[model samples]
Target: MIDIPDSDRQLIDQAIFLPMLLTVLQRDLAAIDKGSFKLKQPYQISIEAIIRDVQKDLAAAKRYLHKNNIKIIRGRSENNFTFYMVMYKGGEEKRSYFNDKIRNNVEDLLDYYLVGRQEER
Candidate 1:
């Protein structure tokens, strides 16, 4: 087992889950983007506020992960190794298929930080 601080688990959870929030937000944002003619100004403002909050949480999580050197890429550290392995190693065939797919998904989450994008609260 990889050795990591308990606080790191919280960080890891943030890293993994926050982008999920972004995905939902982005989905709704897309709808708003397309239906801009239909949505009222106040509704758009509310959605933008939610996006800002998600982005703030995303930035904080990314800062913690970066400060700790826990990269989101595979083979970079024990954290990445565990994350990729736990996800990819369910079966032999499963491992071979997702080298890029799974890693890319994580990269997409990281991209949210780059572009600006969770949290339970």
Candidate 2:
């Protein structure tokens, strides 16, 4: 059962969220923290360049975190998964979906959620 949050579902169609998620995933994956427990960390990340990349594309992931600073942490997970922690001085935000499935669900969920909402009205 893949349960996607409604907010995320809405964002998928906004022409901003899906790309935002991918850019973030790509950016974060490029640079895994040094002390991270995962050897090879099951993922890769590059923090700085991503911010620069975002300027070209609004969905560069770090847009929201602009100058706020973003951090990634690999947590303890049994599966081949790398946990991501997006934080700032205020605290960390909440994410309903973290796995690759979130990316996959982008188009489908966007079509379903947005189109469906239109039909409902």
lDDT of 1 by residue, 56-84 (tens): 87799789767656655323334333333
Cα lDDT listed for each candidate = 0.56, 0.44
What is the alpha-carbon lDDT for the whole of candidate 2? Answer: 0.44
The 10 consecutive residues of candidate 2 with the worst lDDT sum are 7-16
The local lDDT score (0 to 100) that residue 110 gets in candidate 2 is 40
Q: After superposing candidate 2, which stretches have Cα over 4 Å from the reference?
A: 1-61, 72-82, 90-104, 108-121
lDDT per residue as tens, model 2, 20-90: 44465454555455446556534333334333343444443444345435443334433544344434354
Top of the candidates by TM-score:
1
Instruction: Name the top lDDT candidate.
Output: 1
Per-model TM against the reference: 0.51, 0.29
RMSD of each: 9.8, 13.8
